[model samples]
Target: MGLSSRPRCQLAEQYGPVFTVHLGGQKTVVLTGYQAVREALVGTGQRLADRPPIPIFQLIQGGRGIFFSSGPRWRAARQHAVRTLHGLGVGRAPVADKVLQELRCLVGQLDQFGGRPFPLALLGWAPANITFTLLFGRRFDYQDPLFRSLLGLIDDVMVLLGTPGLQLFNLYPRLGALLRLHRPVLRKIEEVRAILRALLEARPAPAPGGGPVHSYADALRQHGQGGDPDGLFSEENVVACVLDMVMAGTETTAATLQWAVLLMGRHPGVQDRVQEELDRVLGPGRPPRPEDQQALPYTNAVLHEVHRSITLLPHAPRCTAGSTRLGGYLLPEGTPVLPLLSSVLLDKTQWETPGQFNPGHFLDADGRFVQREAFLPFSAGRRVCPGARLAQTELFLLFAGLLQSFRLQPPPGLGPAGLRTVPAPAFTMRPPAQVLCAVPRPRGR
Candidate 1:
């Protein structure tokens, strides 16, 4: 929740890759850089993949959801979610189509400003709607009050969870409860739960052929039928699982794209390079397709650079399972772990320009898109983000579509040097509130 240049970086410099830190009297192991984090998380993921219990999250999710929950329940819910998303065409054309549909709406919405200053606040709704379509088999209109309220609640929870007060609450649950410090977050969680409950109730049951309508909810209903008398697919877990996916997917992606647009608008030279690639690979009047990503390497590189530069999650939360030795230290069982992804992204040894927005980190000399091992935005190991592919596809298509349709510009008299890119402190690091103009590209070169 601190600024992007995590204080942990200084700690790593002083204490080496794996050092012990005391947070609220809890002894936790911090893993920094690419090598140490990969070795601990990927090499020994089984022993280090568990989640430490946070009092606030324990109260909010009750350890029922896939995220923040470990052991059999987390395993079952995660497996089912992956299988169900694949069954519903998450990694394929259907999801791409849904993303493109939403992108068009977003582009159209941007056009209404007519080159005037527009804040990218509502930009999150587009990706949120994609999750809505995937989970409940429906999309919310941009102007829908219910949709706005739902997003607002999600925003409130994200912001509240990252506050220092929440940390104090987690440290002393009884005292914080007496003080009502976590009441706002608790209220927001309940509101979201209620919304999920209503959506689940209204969802149509699975058909004989197991059709796509209400695919996720239907699959959860079916999966719950054959499990143990009480299992992860219970009505409660269903809502929690959906909430996990929605919360996990929506804001991170929306923030990523928001940064994408901000960086592009700020860096017009890079934006021009991306537009050149888009125009060369995709002819005039042609809609950008997912397949075009390979041909438009610079565009893809820009997106990857944005992911790296933004440093979305400073550190991913993880914990140890059994006693294990890592980084030449014997970590006791249940040791909390914070794999500093920000450290990895900005590792001086890994990237030539860690702080700057340079797409070359992901591009080869031949100008082709290349993936670096140090790039762990979705994290690594067995607990890596399950929706990585889905997120990538949506990001590429939406980014290309936007660049194809519009030439992003900063506000009048504000150039790249004047544009501020540092993100505000939150659950997810998001670009600061700012205005930009999405000037439409003129017809044909």
Candidate 2:
């Protein structure tokens, strides 16, 4: 938490980008700065592609799902998920329609407040529902008991997974497990699995009209039944895979959306520019499309800035697939490496203003969008986020649509300066809890 404002990059000044940390019983390497992280993750290439065995994730996934799994299982499951998610319209225009639909639903929810304060958690619903639509082939009602339960369980899991107890367990598995430190989150995970099991069983015989909804579950069923190879598609494995997609697809995207709302509220000048661009290009009530990004460079840059500045996953752990040398350091096979992505995103050499919320980081002199090499929020190389395009599409539409429909602001007795932007404790870097007013806009169409 102390590192929130200080940033881990400053540590590089004292220890260089490639330094070692001795955590109780484990000795791991920390890769700071853009050059060092890139050299380790990209330069070493496939040899650094494996996920280190973090005890917490091992308990949750058991090396079965795509997000935390390694070796052939990770490779094959990733291949299958990419093909299936693409076929389900993840990176294509068809999914944009569904995202826009959720935006309308979200707008309606915000309209309920009528310029009153609303909880920050509500912002997660739209993005999370979009993820559910992919996993179960349907979206859930915001008020549904099952939907509410699932979200609550996910909340518990995320917090628990980031708790000190979990970290202690990771460093000393046997001693921590003896004290039952892992049970709380593990119990919550089981509850989630129960819900997933019911959803799998209750699936419609066919996919409504498209034949299996998005049919991700159905695809897994068929894949498991065939060849009888490694049992990667077994019923338990299917549950884990679906669990990975739901958790991965929901939390970070929703967190980013929350940041968008909070940051726009905090910086009204930036919000005004975003609103002007949306109003001029998209017009009132038109809803944003993926293609609209080309014409909405300012809005695009703000959204990108939100991501770059936040540094959601500060340092994702990667294990060496085999022994490899990086930055003149020789690492043994299976060594755990902590690559500081936050440093890369905020590299002094990369951004003109590393600490400020400057959309110009992604803009040229003429204000056209420009991709920077250090803008690696999704990381890179063999272990890059497979759903990167899907996430980008959701973020652009949801963010643009929100700005089009309303002006986000802090509630009564609060001003923009009072709005808290501190990093909250979670598996991912979450924005602090806040209640803000989403005042509706006049269409003037």
Candidate 3:
């Protein structure tokens, strides 16, 4: 509940700039400024690259996937993940087209509401389906049972990870294990692993000579044949990596989109300006294209402002791989470090009026879109999100497409003053369930 609670910037004032938090008998130095974050994440070499041992990820992933795995195994898997995403058109037109299609579907769904107050119950599904299609070459109907189950399992994992009990367990692993206190958590992890295992086992093997199989599963099956070093590309890695992709790619994008909708509903002038820009640029008949982003500076600024205003994951955990000096403190090998990303986003020195919802933060005097170094929704350095580029493209396309087709507004009598964003508090900082009205705009207006 770091920044998930009301008055989200309280921690920044209380902690000054940097502070220490003790967890699991470890000292985690929290970097609150852009300079400090750069020093810890970018300046330091692999000395700060390793991840701390988390019992849940370790138990389910078995140190196979990119998120939980470390050292050489992590390096190989991450390399493969980046390459596979690129080959599959992650940032390119193919993926953008797929996202556009999904945005069309979302627009249709909104239209069906007919300006009624209907909750977008778990809007994460749209992006989740996109990631699923990209990784597994499959998409589930919105009401599909298996799809709902997968989403539930993912939500459970995120919630469990953020629980105070789990944090305490990370500190006192032996004691928690001695009491069999984490059995329920272990069971949930097993459930997800079992689901992934079944999916992996059901996949058909690649044809002889690797005649170009589709999907990450197929790619892993093909490369896993020769037995990668230490079996890093084995079935286990494939399952874990696929899970990582879905988990990482799905909720974060969806949550950010939720924030966008919420923020727009709160500010009609900002929303009107965005719609005007969309109307002037793309018009109502045509869908948004990636190239059009350059022409839509205000729209792009709003997107950036949304990311800056609401950070998805406030802090990213890192551990020192070797001895390193940070901010005049000598940190030993394996010391835990928490890069306070929200602090950076809300750093007064870097941002003018850091607390307000102002799109001007991303715009220069001439009204050109300018990216700030401190504006990093996706963490920086070696372990930066592999899906950053892909997610950005999707967000832009989907956001633009939706705004172009329909006007998002609050329900009658529930104006901007009534719209409040209560934090849902999980692995990500998501807005709580709320309903908004989507009024269809005059076609081609």
Candidate 4:
């Protein structure tokens, strides 16, 4: 289970910084505490960079994408993913425009609830569609059946990724495959791939005049057609990479937004402070922009705190590229290393209040928003999340836009206490099912 690692870190404090934990009969080295995690993942990143093979992910299109593959294959796929996104304006005004556009539609949809309780289940849809637009040159309507199904499948896949069956499959790949325990997961993967294939097929050939590289699929196709002797970016790899973009990008960002809403509702005082900052920084009728992040210090702090409070993935699995020493221990080549990121997020020495939801962790004495080195919600090192900037932008725009436009509150009859947040175990730590009321704020308040 991907629960808090503080207890394990406490054990580490007693035993040692680096200790071995038994997982599915495999001895995995666990690095706890900020100094240990940072030293191994950041200091000797490349040495500890290779991804440990998981049977489930290895079955993900034969492990062709950036997230699963290692060595030259991973390098080429990652380079393509990064370069393609950068070419598509991932960290710039173009991507922000896409996010803002979707956010506007999302706000409008929430307005129809009329301050009534609404499930934030499909909160990931807009961002998923934003990613869809980036990958396939199209966006799905909020109520599109296909779009909803895709999101549902993605959510199910995340749930499956953390199951005991998956763990057993990871440990004994052949036996799990023989038992067909991975069949359900494989079916879902096929469904996701089918969607990607449809979108790829829908793409028209590049114009004879060759104006501009349109979408991610097109960019990938153009690259593949350029005749690579290495065959790094093959057609199958293109689909897998698209799947990676959608899978890697969607739930994490969506879960962050969901946590933001829940936290805002749970702590109305903090929410108000953020709204106050939003109003003071950018007044009525204007949606908050990425540039506004600097001016809106309290809001920025709250966003950072939300990520800190709800550290998503408890740990990231890393493998030693070669024999190397980490945390004062000699790890042999191909040794599996689990960097306890949750420990770092809630490290006692680094954070003033490691257990509480305090935005002050990222706030300076003068109320300026300051970045904390311990904020490793995205994890770090050579294999750090490739979509960090895009995720941050989505988080900022969605968080700021919603707070600016509405006063988020718990469902009627459910106070903060009634709205208890239990962690839903998945590929990430998902928030419990709760309803939030987006009470539209009066204009010019």
Best by lDDT: 2
lDDT of 1 by residue, 1-445 (tens): 2222367889889989988777766877888998998898789868887888988889888898888899888888888888988988887888888998998898889889887888877677788888888888899889998899899898888888878788788777787899999899988899988888888888766664444455677788777666456577788888888889889888888889889988888889999899888888787877777777788889989999999988887776788889988998888889888888989999999999998889999999999999899999989888988888888888888888888888888899888778787677578888888888888886421
Please, what is the whole-model Cα lDDT of each candidate in the order they appear?
0.84, 0.86, 0.79, 0.83
Question: Over the stretch 303-422, how does candidate 3's per-residue lDDT look in tens digits?
Answer: 999999987888777888888998888888887788878878888899999889999998999989998999888888888888898888988987887778767778888888787776
By lDDT, the better pick of 2 and 4 is: 2
Clashes of each: 0, 2, 1, 0
For model 1 the local lDDT of residue 326 reads: 92
Per-prediction TM-score to the true structure, in the order listed: 0.96, 0.96, 0.93, 0.96
Ranking the candidates on lDDT from highest down gives 2, 1, 4, 3
Candidate 4 lDDT score relative to the true structure: 0.83
- Mind giving the per-residue lDDT tens digits that candidate 2 earns over 294-342? 9999999999999999998887788888888977888899888888898
Predicted candidate 4 versus true structure: per-residue lDDT over 160-181, tens digit per residue: 9878777778887788889888
**Model 4 / residue 178 / CA error / Å:** 4.5
Task: Show where candidate 1 strays beyond 4 Å.
Answer: 1-5, 208-213
Estimate the Cα RMSD of every predicted model relative to the unseen true structure. 1.8, 2.3, 2.5, 1.9
**Model 3: lDDT to the true structure:** 0.79
Return the lDDT, model 3, position 11: 54
